[model samples]
Target: MNDVKAAVLYAKDDIRVEEMSVPSLEPHEILVKVKATGICGSDLPRVLGDAAHHYPLVLGHEFSGVVEKIGIGVSRVKVGDRVAGVPLKPCFKCHDCASGNFAQCKYYSFIGSRVNGSWAEYVAIPEINALPFDESISFEEAAFVEPSAVALHALQLIQFQGGEHVAILGGGNIGLLTLQWVKILGAREVTVFDIDDERLETARALGADHTINAKNANVDEDWKTITKGKGFAVVLETAGSDVTMRQSFDISANKAKVCFVGTPVRDLTFTPKQFEQLNRKEFTLTGSWMSYSAPFPGNEWELTLHFLKLGRLNFKALIDRTFPLDNINEAFDLYRKPGSVKGKIMMLND
Candidate 1:
């Protein structure tokens, strides 16, 4: 009920730790004592670039905590339950929401971006947004639910089937998570492409059959070698860069499924030949938005927790480092250095 330490972003490249009053609960909200929160790739633009929609906001979405208090009408979970926070708050009356496509709801409000969020000692969220998990999963691992659900949601978009050749066009956090999901879903062989050697190694350790350094290798020839010149049956572009976006087309097999899960910041153009790949091969091209489906946050969030408890998601390898709540600025500072962050950087409340 007193002031708590929270990281507030006043402007681009300006974030600081300050004492603020803990959020009060609404009739259906739950007060949570946040234990861990992860900095997402999308946060880079909001923190370092000019993507923030508002100034002086608390910006963290991927988080885990223990329920400290509950609203009068809340009954799904008790005060002592452990839970992962869901960021999407779609307007239930929207057309998309009525159709069970909550991610497409135009009037949706998101945590961290559109409102104050969990880069703090305490956060209050809707009771329905608190997805409880058992004690078998650690708090840090539970914090990964959002990103993991994102990866799964993208695959779910394509009705992803396994036992086929799959190529992931990035070895970053989302790419790494995507790689693991495909492997678990029964992909026969998986190849990860990236410029960083360390990330490639991590991908290999996480079940990638091959890791190609796009910077140093002849990517076109190397991918051909991996697939024996047949091309990938399924390709996921998670880098959001022009290079990888175009590569996703080139490496795809005829009539293959391709999904772009990354958000591109710049305008992308393809050449006549490059654009022809979609027409000639008849590739099924689609892009994935924020993770959500029927029944609110959907199976994506539920299955992520299920896998985490089963010890299959490998959250430990995806976390690069952890910092205390007071040093949240120091965590943002890492994003300024090129290629400095190899994985998720977490802020722990304790």
Candidate 2:
């Protein structure tokens, strides 16, 4: 391939579609013809808030495509295989990685940040990063594998078991996906909290036992009634906002497992009262980073595809809108306006 069309980010709020040379593959690499890519919430700051590591980058990680070619030493997948892209590239030699905690590796490179990514017609990825899926799953659905894996990783971090009350403190894409995974994994009751009524409705449709609009309702009182004053056995903080992060601690039951899956943008502080909840309740507080484990990108990626094939993991409603690759700038524009988009915004290439 001589020429490739891509969405190039030149500076903050400055992304354009341009033709660039296709990337060359090295050993253990695969060239995927890009099909569908979801615009992650993290990407907003990279393009609009100047959170990108460098300029003129192709910012995409949640993506799926067909393998156009494979470099030598690539045996897991062949040309024409449908695959999802794993963004994390951890140094296997790091202590964290050697211990099966790839997400904790400090020595690592990331696609879309440290290197070029898949907002283009094609992208060259490591063999282990391209996870092949069955023909039944659409490229759009496969694009959700990264976020789905993220949601699963958080649950796995706490070793969540079924038959306990679970509280999801966000109703965004990741929060909704986490809710679905909670229900699929047999949580006794799943409650989703969000400021948006529409997203709360979506969560209800996705099998959330209860939906709380924290904006209007008294969350402290509502959650008390929902949990029958027992509090949630497991609380997942997915909004990354100051309010929800603190709320996670407040809504937890004694010795509850609380996992922070959302990334916060601003400085966070907790009052002496709020901070004491951890000590008093004996909460197992943990933060989940990128998804990965022993055998590379780990079972989270595979399990996502398995559930997708079984129709247990829903990906359709999570998609709010789809934009053509040529109109990616328009897609980013939607993000500039607050509350303009609800779910995942996908960019598709024909």
Clashing residue pairs in candidate 2, if any?
Answer: none
Model 1 earns a TM-score of 0.99
Question: Where does the lowest 10-residue lDDT sum fall in candidate 2?
Answer: 211-220
lDDT per residue (tens digit) for residues 66-160 in model 2:
99999999999999899999999999997888899988889989987778998999999999998988889999999999999999999998999
Residue-wise C-alpha lDDT for candidate 1, range 156-206, written one tens digit per residue: 999998988999999999999999999999999999999999999999999
- Per-model TM-score, in order, reads 0.99, 0.98
lDDT on C-alpha atoms for all candidate structures: 0.93, 0.92
Instruction: Supply candidate 1's per-residue lDDT for 213.
Output: 94
Q: Of the candidates shown, which would achieve the greatest lDDT relative to the real structure? A: 1
Question: Once superposed on the true structure, which residue ranges of model 1 sit more than 4 Å away at CA?
Answer: none
lDDT accuracy of residue 185 in candidate 2: 89
Candidate 1: C-alpha lDDT? 0.93
